[model samples]
Target: MTTLRIILGDQLSTTISSLHDIDKHNDLILMCEVNEEAQYVKHHKKKIAFIFSAMRHFAEGLKKKKYNLLYTKLTDKENTGSFKGEVKKTIRQHHINHIIITHPGEHRVLEDIQSWETDLNVSLEIREDNRFICSTDEFTKWVKNRKQPRMEHFYRHMRKQKTVLMDDDKPIGGKWNYDTDNRKPPKSNLTIPKPCSQKPDQITKEVISLVNEKFKDHLGELDGFDLAITRDQALKALENFLSKRMPSFGDYQDAMLEGEPWMYHSHISTYLNAGLLLPMECVKAAEDAYLNGSAPMNAAEGFIRQILGWREYIRGIYWLKMPGYADMNFFNATRPLPSFYWTAKTDMNCLKQSISETKKNAYAHHIQRLMILGNFALLTGIDPKQVSEWFLIVYTDAYEWVELPNVYGMALFADGGYLASKPYAAGGSYINKMSNYCKNCEYNVKKKTGADACPFNYLYWNFLAKNKKKLEKNHRLAMMYSTYERMDEKTKKQIKNDSLQFLENLT
Candidate 1:
């Protein structure tokens, strides 16, 4: 029987499960650039271009190997505009009766794929996506009977299981985590190295043109389109990070600068998520750097933990709690995300800088996402759906499996204490301590209230006071509530009035 294998754009690796049992003679690979996927969220223009270019590049690589392949361009006359439509068309044209697919990253896509068997009357075999170190079933098994499924515990499990950063069966540097050594804020004299980048080859140039013509209204520009689009380029990017940046990656992993966006970061997450680089390969590379005495243990362990631990754990949480999880609003937040998110017109320097960088690069480091933008959303009470959509639309690396939990659970705490023990909400002082953004702002970070005060200050307290009934019981926040209770009645009233007035003025 002839088989039609469906490879989604994100599944660009040759090691993808669907391609493992290849029959060059009888199996035909079908890859489509559909409008439905691209237009799902007004995705960043660079993101669309990168994915399309990488898909085209991967298809070319397969063709060089003499595979039976059907590649669909977005402007193909016979293009069906949707994955299922394309699959049906391919089945009729090729007389294919069987379909093989790898499980998709998004739950919504999986539901549609699950329907294809009955809806199209075809034989469907969906294989497990083995690209990740931890399988969905493995994560489920790990969670069985566990009270709180946090990343820290799961990370340690992965470290030992994977034998990563292990010294005689023990974690290197005497601890499973080195976060205490890694939190030095960005200093004034810091010299940030830019990640390795390449000029767009002919294929990428064409893809950029296509994006310009088709998605001109998308969020980000094609200017400075320097991300790696192929596996070879992505490997170079990984090596470059280890040689030049990994040593300092942990120290400033959470730090932010006014104009500096790529401070000691690998910047390969886009490549990692797009399947150009395998997660294990990146993890091993960081581990090798530490053993070779190039990157310190704190840097290597921290970096490895992000890939092997947090990345896997987050994906686990996503699969474990999705479909119903997206609808959670633990804070019952209902405010519309203000227009300043799109325009970067806010007086707060941190928000303005984070949004402006997001508009330019379709990327922001974790702290900017968590403390600045996500923190503001949490503090000011933006609806989770709106915040989630904005994040999904903007980042080049944001697929729903990873992006959803990070934004919904880690960023907004919309899942409440289920995913995070405490809200990541913070005031201007935290930003002031961690970043130089507060230094250049119009509002004073030190001020507690008034017109010239940072909005985060009151918004932070307001979010706490407003959600006290739900959050005060949390052990992590006991001290915070005690501090709030210590304030005199007049001070509390002023805080209430300032918060109301500031939030009311938001548009």
Candidate 2:
């Protein structure tokens, strides 16, 4: 009985679970570049190129191992556009009676895979993706009968379970989080370490050319496609980050610079999400940096929390609450996302820098994503689904499992309070504090109303005032409501009028 083993683009790791017990002679490994997956969201040109190139590189490695592999390039004449169609054709051609695949990362793909058994009339075995530290079953058990699934509580549990940053039974440095120390704003003269970039190999160059020709009208540019497409390059990137950038990573983890897109941030998310670098390896690298005194305890601890804590927590939350989670619109935010999000044609320097960087590189640090683009979307009341889709389309590192929780829950607060305790709504002042974009902005940061004032300043108050009944009861936002109530009627009226006028002219 021949078995067909399917591998998705994100499952590029040779150590992936589905490949564990493969029979080299009888089993055929199937990897395809399906249009259904690539064009599902009009993904960034760079993103498409990266995934395709990485998959091609990985397939070549499998070929060297003498495995029976059925690889379909996108431009191939007989290529089917969907995974199910391709699998059906492959099964019939190879006379296969059994199929095995790792569970897909996104809920949509998982739902589609669930129907494959009946459609193909074969014994389909969907194996668990064991790359993550916490399994879906484990996450579900942790959240069972819980009123609120707080990330910090989950993070603490993971710390104990994994012994990450642990000294015997307690956390090192006498603290679980170094977030307070990690929020220092960028200084104008700070020397930032640049992230390592890999020049494209022959395979990657061909993939880039293909993406340019096919996805010519896609969101981002492919001029400087320097991402690491192979496992060795990914390991080099991780080494560069730990040795050179980890020292200052925590100090300016939340800081942003106008033209500096990387700013001490590890650019390994693309590699990690693509399965080039395993999560445990990254966690251990940071811990090793701390133990060897190559990096500060705060820096190492903060970096570890992101991968071991926030990254894993978000994934667990995603798997635990999908299908219905994407439909959530807790605040009923219905305003359409503005054109500036696409065109980057705005006077707001922060938005311009962040969006432009995304369009050019398909990358932006977490702060730029959360505080700049996400904050604007939240304050302006853009539809959570629209914003979430925009995020999924534009970022190279975006996949629905990671992107949805971040946008729908943390960014827009669309899940009400499931992922985050408070809405991350903020004004221009917060941007000014964290970034240098305000120095070149057209609007005055000090002004709170009228033309020439930062739009965020007035819109922030407008959002609170408009959503008062819905948000005022939250203890986290009680202080802001009290402050708003103390404001004179004339000031409140000016804020409302200016905000409405600004929003009216947004398009």
Candidate 3:
């Protein structure tokens, strides 16, 4: 039987499950750059270029292995602009009767593909994606009877199951997490190692031009596009991080500097999420560095926890609660996102730096994403859907399965503590302690409620007062609520008025 094997843009791995037991001589490989996926959320121009370039490179490698392949470029005049349209045309043209595909990263894409068997009147096989250490069915089993599926508990299960950083059965160094030791603030004279960069080759350059022409109005710039487009380059990037930056990655993982965007960061999420690098490979590289005395145990454990713990746990929660999870609005926030998020025209130095860096590199470290940009949206009551969509659009590594839970549950607390123990809301003091943006900010971080006061100070208090009914009983936020309650009535009124005025004039 003639079969058509389909590959999604993010499924660029050669070991992807859909390619298993393939009859390379008779089976046809199909890859397409369709407008429906690219423009689904007005994705960053660099994001589009990276996926297309990587897809082209992956297709070339398959062609060299003598596989019969059908590829569609975005610029083709006959492009149908949607996956269904392209697949229908291909099935009719090739006289194919069977189709096989790896599961997609996004839930919506998976739903569409599930409908294809009936819609096209062909047998379709959607193989399980084994790229992750924990499969969806496995995660569902893990969380089946638990009241709260905490990441820390799930992380320990993963470590034990994968045997990562384990000494026989117990965790190495007698601890499963090093997050506490990883929270040091940045030093004034901190010396950061430079991350590895790959210049665009002919294929990547062609893809860049294509993105610039077609997505001129997209969210990000295409210049300085230095991501790895293949597995070889991605492996090199992993090696560079291990040798040069892994020693101090734990210490400064949460620190943000004024002009430093990639400070001690791996910058490998784009490659990892794109399937150029496997999560276990990166984990083992860090573990090897620790075993050889090149990197500390804290650094290795910290990095591993992100992938083996948080990344896996979030994916599980996304699959478990999705289709209903997307509509969660715990605080009923309905405010529109301000124009400054796109333009980076805010007087708040923290927001300006984070957004500007995001536009330039299509990346921001975890701290910048959570404490700075995400914190502002949470404090200001911007719609969680708008915040989630913004994150999905602007980042090179963002997909709905990962980005939605982070934005809605962890960032916005829109899921009411499903994904996080508490809302990550903070005032300017937290930013002042961890980052240098406060030094140059026009709004004073010290002032609490006045014309020159930092917006976060009053907004933080205002958020607490506004949500007292829903959040007051939670033990994690009891201390914050007590402080709010102790403040004099007159002082509380001043803070509320000032926060209201600041939010009113935000646009």
- Give TM per candidate: 0.99, 0.99, 0.99
Clash pairs (backbone) in predicted model 1 = none
User: Whole-model lDDT, candidate 3?
Assistant: 0.92
Q: Where does model 1 exceed 4 Å of error?
A: none
Per-candidate Cα lDDT values, in order, are 0.91, 0.92, 0.92
Which regions of candidate 2 are displaced past 4 Å?
none
Tens digits of lDDT, candidate 3, 54-86? 999999999999989999999888899999889
List pairs with backbone clashes in candidate 3.
none
Residue-by-residue lDDT tens digits, candidate 1, 349-455: 89899999999999999899999999999998899999999999999999999999999999988987777889999999999989999888999889998888888
Against the correct fold, how does model 3 do in TM-score?
A: 0.99
**Model 1 weakest 10-residue run by lDDT:** 412-421
lDDT of 2 by residue, 25-113 (tens): 88999999999999999999999999999999999999999999999999999998999889989989999899899989999999888
Error of 3 at 13 (Å): 0.2
Ranking by lDDT: 3, 2, 1
